[model samples]
Target: MFLSTILDKPVCQPIKKPYERWYTFMEKNVEFWLPDSEWHTKAHCARVLLLALLIGHQKGLSEEEKDALGMAAVFHDSRRHDDGIDKGHGSRAAAYYKEYCREHGLSYDAQTYYITYYHDQDDSLGLSEIAKSSDLSEQAVLLYQIFKDADALDRFRLGPDGLDENFLRTEEARQLVDFAKDLLQKSNETNA
Candidate 1:
């Protein structure tokens, strides 16, 4: 079934299925940096979270990797000031994620931090930095690519020509283009 089907029903209605936990968690927990933003709201984050998990699963990510991806998805845009190319929102979101995890007594994953911190930056620059950091594992680099691709998949919300398949980091993400467009359309309908 299309993932968008879940949002077709009332937001309060229970959804019992795979990935439902993340869906519920995002609905209850995601806090937008620009709460009133037309483009960067909870719905956008939730869709990214779902896309990340789907791509992560296809890439054989471990539970720990998936955890980092989930965190990155929810917080990556949590600090955006506006929809227009907010250059450093990723870094702000990364800092917020660190503080949030600390306040909640959750373990802070560097992979998550790096992914969120550099997601909005240029891919070559981000990967170059990751390559130079000896502390970051190859898995961190993979997660970064996966997380970015997940975020990119949701670009359909920006309208036609918003997403370019060649820019996606993973073939898995490329495969989801049609589904992403459908999700955005259905999500808009549900919210409207």
Candidate 2:
């Protein structure tokens, strides 16, 4: 088969030694520098990657873009802790990605050479720019949209008690966002 199809054995995680080290350092140190909010947690980033990969794979993103999506998820908020807000997380992510690529033998630039550009909701236009700059047709924008919305879904909601009304505008994101909002409303009622 041209594809691996169902679970074929694990080839292993893609990151090499230097890449692993840089990530380890970044993960270990990023939190103390960030505010103690749900927006800056490692767990949040992990889920964002999972959601991106789920949508990307379901939609058949290339192997490189798939890998870049995960890298982008990790790096999107990598620099937010340092600045006390998400001010330039995308560019910071880009710089960090470039450093990681250079430090290792990787052959791509985080900014100009990859399909995934790590961006926060605070950097929505950057997300739009990355999607436009990529080789995706209109349909593939759906993949990027999923990633963007999924991350936004996580940010504006946290379990059954968290919901943000403004995020429910798009039909694509409506189901997830509405479900969360309903759950939050139910929980509030129950508590009341």
Candidate 3:
């Protein structure tokens, strides 16, 4: 589920089931692409997706924009076969996204493709070659940051010294990292 809090204020929005359809879709398909590893579980993808939605909302992104970012978050690492620094996982996942979209008769967006393909690499704007090739829009760049920061915020899943605030992109994301850790802990407890 996407977060309902905006700037730490709890809003009265109802739980949007369709917003969660992305999770349902991925849950059914992830096993085909993702490794059976402790670090790349569906739970981790869920946390990253929810965090991306929260950050996107805080950045004033529209629902459609958030949905695109949500897609990237859920599918970004699905191509990893190993938990440890799988270098080309992002590219593979991005390719899987295309295949999934084609097979499912859904249209693929190039911006989402670029964001998901490079989510694990350097900062969105740090790679001059990628930046020039993608010709990313301002919104795409912001969405990329939101997606990357959201995933990074869940580093607590790695271990005690997991989350590093310096890796977080936005100030708001840094503020929310602890909350992400709490969510991870509670999720683990419940699942345990």
Candidate 4:
């Protein structure tokens, strides 16, 4: 909907049921406010969702597991929509997930309050307070790793108009640099 308005692409037909409503709700609710110029927008969220779904599917997660990942991807930035400075965005993401589920009659197990907020902090900072086990596990710290990767892949536009490292911060983020580079090379070959 909004993406069609932004990109001039043909509007995507909504999915059959809850996904349709969920997407419509997201379109209505999410603000275009990007925290930084690098890449933060509804389009960015969509890209991450796509990537998250792809990864979850490729890794063979169950329907519910995939759903949890999807839930996380959708609500990841719901906080930034509120424009609050004191409440951290990730923590807000967790809170918003709870509220969104209750209001919409969707189901979600566990929560992300701890992971989103403290995922970036170092061990020396102290034991991170967890409100509950995350619906998604970081797996060798790989959930965050994958999430960071997906976000980077979108920001760097690795497959198409690709993103650069200017905005990427983690070692995992840096990994996508080569991916983008490889894609660029392949594109050059295809064009030539």
Clashes of each: 0, 0, 0, 6
What is the lDDT of every predicted structure here? 0.82, 0.50, 0.74, 0.48
Give the true-structure RMSD of model 2.
9.1
The alpha-carbon lDDT assigned to residue 189 of candidate 4 equals 48
Model 4: lDDT to the true structure:
0.48
* Tens digits of per-residue lDDT for model 3, 3-62: 323223352132144347767777776554555678887778877877777777777888
Q: TM-scores of all models? A: 0.88, 0.56, 0.86, 0.54
| lDDT by residue (tens digit), candidate 2, 26-134 | 4654433354544555555644554455455555666665565666666666556553445656666667667767877776633332323434443366556656665
User: How would you encode candidate 1's per-residue C-alpha lDDT over 1-192 as one tens digit per residue?
Assistant: 225575444431322243566666656766776989988887888788877877887888988888888888888888998989999999999999999889989899988888999999999888988888877898888999999998999998887998989999899999889878877887787787
lDDT value, candidate 2, whole model: 0.50
* Candidate 1, poorest ten consecutive residues by summed lDDT: 9-18
Q: Which 10 consecutive residues of model 2 have the lowest summed lDDT?
A: 1-10
Q: Candidate 4 residues 1-192, lDDT tens each?
A: 322331222212221232344456567764433445233445456555544544544455555654555566666765564433334666667677777667878664553333344433442331234323444354424444445455556644334545655544345445445544543344334435
Comparing 1 with 3 on lDDT, the higher-scoring candidate is: 1
Model 1 per-residue lDDT at 12: 16
| lDDT ranking, best first | 1, 3, 2, 4
Ranking by TM-score: 1, 3, 2, 4
Error of 3 at 117 (Å): 0.6
Off by over 4 Å in 2: 1-38, 82-85, 109-118, 121-124, 131-143, 156-192
